[model samples]
Structures are given as structure tokens and as C-alpha cells.
Target: MPAPQMMGIYPSDSISEVAHSLPIDPLGPGAADLLAGDVEYRLHLILQEAKKFMIHGKRATLLPEDVEYAMEALNVEPVLVPPRPLPIPSFQPVSVSSTSSSSHQAQQVYHTPDDEIDFAAYLKQPLPAGIASSAGVKWKAHWLAVEGVQPAIPENPAPGTSRAGPSRPQPASTSLRPQARAQLPQELQLYFTRLTTALVPPTPSAPETEPERHRLAALVSLRTDVAVAGILIYVIKWLSESIQKCLMAPTGTIGQLVDAVDAVLENEGLFVEPYMHQLLPPLLSIILTVPLGPHPPSSSSSSQPSPYDVRQRAAEVLGKIAEQYGKSYPGLIPRLVSTLTKALQSPPFPSPLGAAHPPAGRYEGAVLGLAALGSQAVKSGVWGKAGEGLSKIDELAGRLYIDGGKRKNPLIRATIKALSPLITAKPADVQAPQINMNEVTNAFGPYIANGLVKKGWTANELLRLRKEEMEEGEGGGEGMDMDTPRI
Candidate 1:
């Protein structure tokens, strides 16, 4: 069996592509009314459904068409359209001086104000809430639109209403208000009853209306992929927004906005767009310093973040960004050093008269980022910054070994590593402690004279040496070194 004929075939992962349509309404009562979001949830559903489809030797690619089929199978409302045609105006002109104008005009021309959108009610909608938080569900509608499954069409909708057609909220069977009952004309009742029945989605007829049945005899695939696709889409969008701000903003607005990048950085998601680690520090630096006006603390009670916390958080995000997409980032050394130094300061001194503030973090990563830059720059053909980069190693070493508590641990080892690449480093010459006279004389003066005599030095030379030693010994011998080896 020649390899089971698995030739010239390829599979594509479309989770990121159809990710825009990740939100779907899962089954249950009142699900229609509940806002449907949770794209991550939807993706899991799609994966499960896709797995079943795979066993039958189907194409692995989850195309938009496949997603559409999956949505239908799952009984999800991925698309909505205008339920009825709009009241078209025939363009008939009317005279302003018509006889029955005042009361009649008010009745005809005035429109009711939109019922205030119940933000609470909207948020309570299951799907919308999740989309807002994680971001994938909101884009699902667009995904469907792109796939030719149009948006919900509205009937004769209220004026000033956003007419994403046909998707009007029919009063739920469980509306808050009590139902009013009255006898209606038989024809009207029949028409309404039929419409309601059509509107009410029944449990999907499985293994028949579903695509799986067309291909296989007994397999029934239930794929509710909308949620995950939507979530991924939302995240993509969120990342898009983040990337735009990170890359395009004149200066970052990390802390300036009410809902800023702090949420994203602190949140639990990494595979974001333009995912460069170097961007993180710079991004945060922009936030902390830039923007036209300083972002005052939220309240007196809100404590300012310690320099260490802020710097660490930024560093952590950068580390992950680098780990995930370091390939895309250029100028990592300069960018990292630039940002880390910013982290170590409270912004630059504005002027001679500017108000002073405390120092930023001890510039913890400056040494590391610059050190890494020294070697990395050489490899990347960015050797121009190497000279300046080597300076960081010396600076860090000086701080560690001479200034900052004279630490002698991993920090010193790291300093050494950082300094190893520099051509300018020399072993530091520290002054020796005071020495005993006995040690000095025994090691240098008389011992040298004795050794010289034993080596057959003339008596004249010995007498000269003894007289010189006596003269040198008269003083404190601060600069004496009469024990020069002669033999």
C-alpha cells in the first residue's frame, strides 16, 4: 500500500483567518436573548466538530465556507438581515402652507427618542460581554459578511436606529412585563403565528440538514465554532489597536488613557501583533512619560507603582514578546537600552528650573540590555553602537564592585560577563594595606644584603649596602626598596 495515497495534499490552519467569526450562540433556552460572545469557547467547539469531520478524510482547512456550514449546524445566528423592506418614499412634494399643518405636522414628522440603550442589559448579553473583554466575538459578524453571510436585516426599524437589518429584538417569551391577551382576527393571528414559528429556531435536524450527512452515512457533526473564531478575531483587533498605538503613536499613551495598555500587558495573552519584546519597554516608557498632560493618579488613595514593579512588568512583557517574535524586531539593543534607561529615570530633566523627582528604578536592565547589545550588534552588523555599548559594562561593573555595597555575588559575575567583550577593561589596581616593618626588612632590605653577600658580593659593596640600609631605616621607609635582586 504505497503510503496510503497521502500525496500532494496540504492542510491550512484558519483559526487566525476565520477568527473574526469566532462568536456563536450555543444551545439552550433564552440563548437567543443572551448576548453571545466567548470566541475562545466557540473555537473549542469548532475544533471538536472539525475533529469529527477529519476522521472521514475531509480537507483540513476550515475555510469560511466550512465555518458557515458549521454555524448553521450549530444553530448559531452568525448572520442577520433586514426582515422587511424599508418604507420607500415616493418623493411626492407637499406645500408648506397646507391647511391642516400644526397638530398634523407634529403627529407625522416627530419621531420618538430611542429607548436609552440599557448598557447593563447589553453587557448582560452573554456573547457581547465576552467579546468586549477578550475581543474576538465582535469581529465575527464581519467574518460572516466577508463569507457572504450578510448581517441581520431589520424590518421597519425605528428611526435613528442603527439598521443592521432584520436583527431586531422580538420581545422574548420571557419578557419582564406581563403579556397582554386579546382576540385577534383569524388571518392576522395565523400570519403572526407562522412568523413566530419561523423566527423560533427549533432543535437543528441533525445528520440530514448538516453537511456531514452528504459525505458520510452515519456521522453527525456539531460544530459551534463561532465563539473561538470571534474571540481570536477580537484579540486580533485588540492587537491591531495595540500595534497601532505602539508603532504609530507619536508618543505612547500607556498610562494616559482610561483603559490603556496596562490592561493588555497585565492580562493573560501573548500572541499579539507586532509582537516584539523591545517594543514593550519603549511602549511603557512612552506611556509613563509622554502625552500632552501628565496622567495624574486616579485618587489620593492609589499608590504609585514602585520603580521596580513598573520596570519588572515592562521587562517581563518584553521578554515574552522577544521569545515569541524576536525575529521581527530590529535594533533590539538600542531600543532596549533606550527604554531601560528611561525606566531608570523619572523622565528627563525638563529644564534647570524644573521640579526634581526621585530616581527611576536603579536602571536594573541597563547593564544587561547594553551588554547583550555589544555582542548582538556585532553579529547583526550594527557595530556602530559597540563602543558606546561597551561603556555600559564598565559603568555597571563600577557600580557593582566600587559603589553599590561592593556586592560580590551573581551581580559581580554578571558584570564580569558584561565586561568580557570590551577591549578597554583593565584590572583595577587598589592600594595595599599597611605592612609590618619586620616583614618589610626581612623580605627586602637586610635579606637582600645577606643574599648578595652569599652570592660573593665584595665587602665594599656589603659595607655600602649596610650603611644605606641604616640610613633608609632611620626614616619611616615609606618609599624604600633596597632589596633589588642582584645575583
Candidate 2:
């Protein structure tokens, strides 16, 4: 039997037409048949590769992009075709009579019509604007939901809506306004809210009684809570703002703020070293500010401790800070001493040279602050500079005594207290040598000498301390000179 002839989807007639269009003689029967079969096989291979791409993409139908990708994968040069809708071709029928006339058949051919243009009209027409190129692919991120609540933003889908349409609106009472969620955990947020609320005092008009009980509880939490480091910044911010508000117009709240500071300082779990800069300003302001709260009415006999008492408490807090951090931050003590010295040295009244003099309350606070820094600071800041600090205090105290008398005058007591550290012997059993009163009177001036005598300090102790202070100053000056390099 003869071998079977293979069939091809491409027609020999189409191959012959292509040869004629290339300005070559129409292909012979054998050549046309061979070419048609090869072309049909290549088409099947290309289609097969394109089908794989469509399946990989999970697409039901093949696209032009898939065909391009398929051609590239098969090492064939892909056709560069602009994306457009495929035009429908019209089919026309033609009758052909064979040479024998016995065979006649109708053949159908499909061809797309060419688009005709009128050159004259086309030349007169305005040019179409060029299409802008699309932007390159980019990626961005935005929060879709936080803590199970979807945020209301353009990127997030609207609530109660879908691709179909919006659903019915819920009742006004049932719908809640979306609030911005805190970055903190839920438990921490609740704790912070409760802590701050309890710490802040109630306003005078508010009927919430027992603000003290709440404040004390809050302070205890600050002192004892172990996991409060996370909220440390928030607490510091609250303290700073509260101190500022209280400084502007002090109330019982100012005293509570001091207690809160002390409580935070006492917490061993907190690493407050980083926040010391922020903590110090408010504390210093409290210690140095005059008349922390309004003076009580003279007619009423109010038993509340005056603003001076609050200032004293502030000084104690400052002293604790200095003792704890003085070694770590070497400049802390000097800076504090400088500030208090300036306040202490200011004239009791406005000077004739128009210098700004701090109030008597500030003078008292300065003396207390210097004394709180320990004996060394007291010696250097108050009793150093050839006893100028003491002379200034004596002048201020004299004026106070004349106005309010010695019993009521706080400056007199503060000055005496500041002197105690210098005059008191370090060892209990150590005996100070006896010195003449005239030498003591001349060395320290009359007022300080008299005050020392009144405070039960002997002339010998006063002169001895003054002599030691001078000798230390001379030794420090020599040490500095010896350490200096000569050019």
C-alpha cells in the first residue's frame, strides 16, 4: 500500500499567493505543499507554548503578551505589534471552472479591507494630541486595620459597603465614631489614663471628694510599679506641664506635683538618667520660684502650709537629685550652685543702678537650696568669696527683721542654718581651738560674727573654718598653675 499523505491547516494556494506577492513566480505544486506543511507545524508549536503561559497565569484565554513570551522562549523573534482590537474580515465567494468544465466549485476567501484616507482632508485636519505614557509600576504601604478596627482612609474599604453597593446605614446610637488607636498596648493605655487622672487634683468647683486619697495611690504606683519604664516619657511630660501650670498659678496641685516628682525619682526600676535634663528644669523652677501660691487672706486663719513650705519641699527634692547624680554628672552641682548663688546675691530691694532684685521669698529659697547641696556647696557658694554671701544675707535679714521682727523673719533663720554646716565640727569628740572674738569679728565682719555667736558657734570655730576655706582656695590656685603648660 502507498504511504498516507499528511494534512496541514495552511493551504498550498495561500503559499503560492505569498510567492507571487514577493514578485517571484508562483510556487510549483510540490514546493507549495512542502512549505504549507512546515508553516502549519510551526503555528502548532507556537500555539502550544502560548497555551502553557496562559495556564501558568491562571487565565482561561491566551493573550498577545503570552504569545510574545512564548515566541521569546522558543528563540524566535517576536512580532512588534501595537495593542488594538482585531478587525473582522469579510468573506467573498468566487466560482472557478476547471479546464474540463465538468468540475466547477465555489471557493471562499477572507480579506480585511484597507482604510482609505483623503489626502487633502487629512492635511487640513488638526493633529491628534500624543497620548501620555503610563506611569511605571510602584509599590506603597498603608495601614489597613489596627487592633482589629479598620482605619477610615482612602486605601481602606468603606464600612458597610462592597463592590455591589453600600449597605443600609446603621442607627445613630449604635454607630461609634472611629478613634485613633494609641500606639501603646491596651492594658498600658488603661493604666496610663487611670494613673494620670488620679494624679491630677480635682478643680475647686468639682464635687469629687478625697482627691488626696487618689493622689497618694497614684504616687505609690509611680514609686512601686515595675513596668512603668514604657510610660516614663509620658510621665515626664505630664510633670513638666503640671509644673508649668502650677508655677503660673499655684494651688494644692503644686505640692502634689512635687510629691509626684519625688515618687518617680524613688523608683528603682526606672532608668531616669536619660530624662534628667527634662526633670531638672521643673524641679529647679519649683525650688527657685517665689511665692509658689497666692498668699492667704489676713482675715482668714487658714492652716495650710504656705508657699514657702512647698519651696522647702522642692529644695529637698533637688538635694536628693544632686546627691544621686552629682558624681555621674560632674557639672550638675556647679551649675546648681551658680544658679542659686545668683539668686542669693541679688539685692533685697531694687538697686539704684536699676538691677533686677529677686523677692524676699526667692532669697530664702536660694539660701535653702545652697544649704541643701551639702556643706561643701554651702561653704563654696554661700561662705566663699571672702564671706560676701553672708554679708548680703545679713543685710537682707536686717531689713526683714526691721519689717517683720526676728521671730517672723525667715531670712534670719535661713542664714543661720546655711552657717551651721561650716561651723559644726566633723567629729563629735574633736575640740576646736579657742580664738579671740576681735579676730572673729574682723575676719567675718560684725553681723555674721554676731549671728554665729547667737547660733552657739564659738569665735574659734568660725575663724578656723574661714582659715581652712582660704587655705583650700590657695592650694587649688597653685594646683591649677602647676598643671598649666607654658608656651
Candidate 3:
């Protein structure tokens, strides 16, 4: 056995290197007389050290440990240094080394990686005799906890300098080290143990909402997530088409729609519902016309691509599906309305009516959403108050697309068409169906009437449609553009 190295040999040697005798100078005392034999042996010890200190052509003699080594070599007997001729190398070797001593030495040499973790425990006590467990600990992979903004590891932790960066495990150190454990208060030890135990075993991870996001930049990279998003959109839209084609999709499909929507909304932080409300009218405009034949009029097909048979279809369909299942989708329409209302209603900056809030692209969206509900109603033959829905949207977004310069917007004309009967003087015998017209008429009625007025239609025609609206002054009903659900 080579035997365990004693602490006395290393750090004790270092401390003794300095003279107990007061130094005559700040640089300190020089070495006293030592025998030639001692100098030779000391040179031998220097050779034993690993070739770690070489710089240029010279080895440094500056370490405190070097001084102690020199002193020890000096103490050897005079005869040992007496010069003699060197012998040739021998091939003979000892048979075997003792297993017990070898194993112990291995244990002493091979520390668990966790022993190298960040803090130097020896500094908290007495300074360590030698380099404390190889500079630092491996960052135990187990130490990773819930993610949040982590503070920087300061070169100098004291206030002032710009933060270096948040500390993260060096790539080499990213591994689990079972031996590493944090000391905890007795009161909290079990809690910590439980936490560490829970963390160390790889907890089941929720599926990657976006692994593709890592490779692709948010704005640029053609989203791999786009495939996923597209699939979801396809599924939802197909479900929608199936319903529109089959007259009301199965309730289970509705569940799948919800799950898909929630998964998307949660992941993207986008509300597909309102966007659908915004997107669908345009899509259904096509879908509605899909029934209208092979030589479908250029008027129906021109200006935009159809929203069906593709994933881009999803964006439009998302809004409609949300409208399809009211109340089941909270934070859907109201939130959308709030955002879109702010945008459309916002004046240009440095103008009247509050700081020009950003536009939400909702004016057309609201009209589209209400119209989608109308399509569903019309398809199901459920007129309920969809007629009234058209009216309500009229009060809020004032025939902007229809009369606000762009007489060319197809959606504007579509809105007028759907509610044409309600807006024009309907014969009393044209019975109102007991379906939801609130989403339709309230959302579009006024706009239809106003379009008539702007087109120079008679007042009799305005009076012809049921004016559920509260007239401006007398306010018999809700005033112009009240967004409250007429349902």
C-alpha cells in the first residue's frame, strides 16, 4: 500500500515554508545554507510534480509549497547525496499490489461528481489544505427547479456593475449527481427531500407545445408548429364543415374542437374564437356560395382565396366555431369585442377620444362573427334572433365597410344580403323564426338600414325592419351599437 496521504504532509508543509523568524523585508527572507545532497533530492521532488506549471522555458519556484519541499529535501543524510554512477533499467517487477489499499486509494481519488458542486464548504470552515475538491462542483442536474428569471452570478456580487448573465450550468456539468444534497433546516428537511426526490426522477413532462419554436425564430422560421396549428385548424374546420354539411357536428367533435382550441389558445396566447369570428364570415361567404355551383359567379370567387380545404381555413373557421358554442368558450367574444372595439373606435394619435389605442381589426370581425352565427342559424333553419344580431352590430360598427368609402368590401355587401329581408320592409306575414337573431340583427340591423339610407332608400323602408334599437334621444331600447348579447 502506498498509504493514505496525511494532511500534515501537504498544507502543513505550506504553512511551515515561511520563517517563524520575523522577515527582515516585505519580500521576506532568503533560504539558509542547505547541503548539496538536499538540493539534489529537492530537484527530484520538483521532477515528480506534474508538468502543469511550465511557462516559456522556465519553471516557477514562487509557490509556498515549493519552499517547504526544498526544506524537506535539505534534511536528508549527507551520504545520500554522495555522487555515484547510475544503474541501467531493470525489467523485473513486483508480483502484485494489495487490493484493499488499492481500493481505498481509488475511493480517495475518485470523488462523486456532486462533490464538485458550486459552493466551497471548506471556505466556510478552515481554509482547505489543498485545492478544494478540484476548483468547483459539477452543477447537479437535480438542482434544476421551476424556471423563472434567475439572477446573475456577479463577478463581484456587490451592486454597480452590469449583470454578467443569469447563471446556468456549464454544458459539461449538466448531469445528475446523486451524492449532492442541500443542507436544510430540520423543520424543512423532509420537504426538501420530497422536493428533490420529486424533481430528480424525471417528472412527466407535458407534451411539447412547441419544440419547433426552438429552431425557428418567432417571426421568421416557417413554423413547424404551423403544421400542428394547421392540423388543429384542419380538424376544427373539418368538424365545422362536417356540421355544416351534416347539420350540427357530433357533441364529441365539439369537445375535440374545444380541446384543440384550448390547446392552441394556451400555447399561442391567442384567442382563436374571436379571430374565427373575424375570419369566418369571409370563409363562410365562400362556403355559403359553395352551394351556389360550378360556374359560381366571379363576384363570389374574386378578391380572396377560399377559406376551405386548407389550414389557412382554420384561422377563419376558428372564429366561427367559437361562436358556434357560446358560453362554453369564455373570454372569447367579449374580450375580442373589447380589443376590436378599441382598435376601430381609436382615433389617430394626437387626436380626439383617448390616446389612440391600437386597432384590433374587429369592426369587420364583429360583423363576420355575427354573420357566421347567422349562417349556422340559417343552415339549421333556426332564425331565433340572428336577425336582431345583424341589427346590433350595425349600431356599433356603423356601416363602416359598407358606407365608409370602401363600397367594394365583399363582407359589407354580404352583411346587407343576409339581413336584407330584416332591413327592407318585410311583410307582416313574413314570420320571424324562433331562432337566435340577436347575433345577426343586433349586430347588423342598423348598418343595413343605414346602408339603405345612404343609398337613398325611403324612411318607410327603415321603419319596415324592426327597430329594436333605443332611438338616440328617447332611447326606447339600447342606443346605437350596444354590444350586450340580445340572446
Candidate 4:
């Protein structure tokens, strides 16, 4: 079969002329045509490569560098063409002015002292670059004259109104309050994808089989980078919203998320410490109120992990975080106490779309959240304050025990266990433990005082050794007459 013809992008006539332009060459009959065909093929390849370069650079216009880069990538030497100087346009001076003005006026045409009519030279002169006239080009119909006292157009907008012409349409409000997640920026979307994947892999099959790869990676990220921690907070917020809007429970991802949070609490890194104040609210919400996972089918037996289990896990995670970081963030305890008290007191959610009170698991979660804060939270009458000395937590726990001691209610039992230490002893009898200042100072030695004075190097003996080493180094020399004692 005859070879299929190749379509040429460059004009054959131009290529042929360039081929013939070589001084010593007399044209062979098909040589010019062959060269033209080759040139066309090369040009087509260059254009294709240049298009790819343009796309990679995210530019619509194909620049000279794009072609050069394409040539370099393809191992083709490119012809360098020097840029020609721009032709300077000349201008003839024309005098223009208002003829109606009776006062003496300066000449309308401005000129340098040389008086030659050279627009380029005039432009090159060290003078301000601007239109000679005071007026700007008007693109739309503007009221040149406004109400008598209102500032004229372009200088200032009319009083109380801002348009020179009809105003542009206002964008539709994209308020995401009741329904959807807020639209994240493109960069944030990418970060969210990477972070969520790092938190909980897409196809997590078993919790115990692997070494929690994504969870470890996320903790490492939190330990080092504040920005990563912020991204995790963003993810947590988004997760809360997702749980709120979800029609049914999600898969076991919620448990994985709780595990990831627990890992962060366990890693006592600098970055995660300061962000606890911001981190606690969403975490408490997850424990006290947010849905954990998809509800089991009604036909399924009670053997399936109940919704309360997820809340309990979230509650445990909260307790761990509070036990670890709550001292640093004092406000966290009070907020948790308030939230738990409210949840415990509030009625169950009436329906899917009603004023949100709390869920069945919320009561349990509230107790757990309080327990996470330790005994002080319960002793403070977080549930309520009846009188000057009456303990509300004691009163509530007593009532629950009386109501269901034999029933073996887990939530009530947990609450009772948490509050038991605080309530068992009267406040008057439980005196604050006394500390011997001299004993503490003697046990810690001068190290504590030295650290406070010096701002570092807490171990006094180590500091003394370091100082002696430094002093010895100062006395030693590379070359010395050791035996000769001369003054």
C-alpha cells in the first residue's frame, strides 16, 4: 500500500523558500519539497509540545519561552531571534483650548526648551507620565452634575449612594447555616482531602489488624505543625456538621475519628497544647450530642454495638483530653460541666426537625464528659446548687441509686463512681494537704532556684560540671612550656 500522506501545518512555499535561501545550494528537483515536508513535520511537533507547555504553565497564550522549553525537552536546537526595537511614533503639536474663556491662558501645547516636535523625546524627558488634559475617558453615562451640594461624579460618589451608573446585581447569599457545609477554598479542599485520608483511610477494614497508620501520621503532624492541627480542627468542625446533617448513621468512620483524637491527646507535643481551648468544644459536642454512626436496622438484635457505645467512646476520648490538657485551659471544665448539666436536664429530641434538646445517648455522654473533668467538677455543684452547703451532685447520685440500684444502669453507675470520691467526704473534714517548703527545696536542691534564676539548666551539679569544663578549657592551651616556671 502507498504510504498515507502527512498533513503539513507550515506553508510548503515558505519552507521551500527558506530551503533555497542557502547561498551555495542549487535546488535538486525534490530536495526543496523534501526539506519543506521535514520542516512542516518539525513545526507540527513543536506546536504540539508548546500546547502542552502552555497547559502546564496554566496560561492560554503560548509564549516564546514555551516553544524554547519544548525544543529543549525534545532535544531539538531552537533558532534564537533577537527582538527588534519598537518604532517610535512621532506627534505634531496642535494647540487646543476653550475659546469662550476670556482670561489670559498659557499655551495648550507643552514643549521642552529645544522646541523640536519629537513625541519620543518629549516622553523621554524626566516629566510625569499622564494625559495632558485633566479629564478621564468616561465609559458609561454618569451624572456630570449631581444634586447641588453632592460631590461631582468620579471625584466622589453622590451622598448616601455609590453608583455612577446602574449598580451591578448583588450575588445570591450562600448562607450554609441550616443545611449544608460551608464551601471551603480550593487549597483548603485539597488539605481537607489529605488530612481526612490521613485521619481515617478510605478503606479501613479492621481497627486492630494494622498499626493505625493514618492515626499515627495525623498525631505526628499535630505534634509538629500548628497549621496541621488547625486543619484537623477544621476537619473536626466539618465532621460535626456532617453528623448533624446525615439522614442515617455513617459507617465506623466515627470510631476511627475518635481514635485519631485520642492519639492527639496522648501525644503531649507543644503544638497541640495551646490549641486545646479551641479543640475542646467540638470534641465535647461529639461526645455529648453529635451522632456517632449509622443506626442499626430495627430488625437487628440488640447484640450490635449500640449508639450509646460510640458516645461512650467519644466521652472517654474527651476525658482523656481533659485529664491531660484541662489544667492548661481552665474554661474547658466549666463549659463541659454546663453542657453535661444541660444535656442531663433537657428532654430528648422530639423529632428529627425540631428544637434540638438532647439525644438518649447525650445523657450518658454528659455524665462521661463530667467524669472526664475529674472530681472537682462534680464537687462544684455542676449539676445544680440547692443551698449554701448542699451538694447537688451528691443529691442526684443518691436519687439515681435509690431509683435503680438493682437495675444496673451503666450511665447512673458511671456518674456515681465519678462523683463518689468528691461526695463521700465532707468538705470541712477533707483539709488541703500540707507541704514542707524546706523539705521540697532540699529534695529538689538548688536546681530549682538556679533554673528560676538562670531560665535554663535546672540540674545544678550538671551546670557546675559544665562551668568547670568551660573554665578548664579557658586555662588549657594548644602549645605550652609545662616544666619551666618563669614569671
Give the TM-score of each candidate.
0.24, 0.53, 0.24, 0.38
- lDDT order, best first, reads 2, 4, 1, 3
Worst 10 residues of 1 by lDDT: 216-225
**Per-candidate alpha-carbon RMSD to the true structure:** 27.9, 24.1, 28.0, 21.7
lDDT of 4: 0.53
TM-score quality measure for candidate 2: 0.53
lDDT of 3 by residue, 330-444 (tens): 6565554444334333432331222233221233433343434435432122122423444444444443332444233443444454444334454567653333333323434
lDDT of 1 by residue, 1-487 (tens): 2222222212112333343466743334422222133444576687666555554457766555665566777887676567898866454343343356454442223333445898778766677555567844452222234365445545333435566543422212311112211344444344333322222223222335643233222111101112222233233333334433432221112221212233333334333454333335454452233221122323421343333333344444555444444456555545655654444332333322242432222334443343444544222221123133223332433433323332333323333344445323333573333334343234333222222232222223323343555666665353444433431
Clashes of 3: 51
- For model 2, how does the per-residue alpha-carbon lDDT over 1-487 read when each residue is reduced to its tens digit? 4333548778988888878879777665478778888989999999999999999999989998999988999999966666897866775544554556665655455555667999878666654444224355334578988999889889888975754542322111211113312556767767777787777655432334577678778899999998778778777877876686566343456677788889999999998888888888887787777555544323321544566777788889899999999999999999999999897776565433333443577777887888889997887777767566666666666664445432435765676676776665546676545446567557755555555554334556656666777888999999889888752
Residue ranges of candidate 4 with Cα displaced over 4 Å: 1-195, 201-204, 207-248, 273-278, 290-292, 296-305, 320-329, 347-359, 381-405, 423-487
List candidate 2 segments past 4 Å from native.
1-181, 203-209, 248-251, 295-301, 348-358, 399-408, 425-454, 458-460, 467-487
Model 1 misplaced stretches (Cα beyond 4 Å): 1-304, 328-348, 351-353, 357-487
- Model 3: runs farther than 4 Å from truth? 1-316, 323-325, 348-362, 373-411, 414-487
Residue 87 in model 3: lDDT: 62
Clashing pairs in 2: none
> How much does candidate 4 score in TM-score?
0.38
What range of 10 consecutive residues in model 2 has the weakest lDDT sum?
168-177
Model 4 Cα lDDT, one tens digit per residue, 1-487: 4343445555656755765676766766655556667877888889899999999999999998899999998999877665897755565565666566785554476444445688767555553445434466323444545566565567666566664653322211222232224555556556556655666554434455444665566656654555544355564554444434321334345565566566656544434565565556656666665344443343432333555666677778777777766687778667777777777665555533332332345656776667666776654433232211123322333343334433435454455445444433425655434443343234332222222232222223323333465566655642245534542
Q: Give the whole-model CA lDDT for all candidates, comma-separated.
A: 0.37, 0.71, 0.36, 0.53
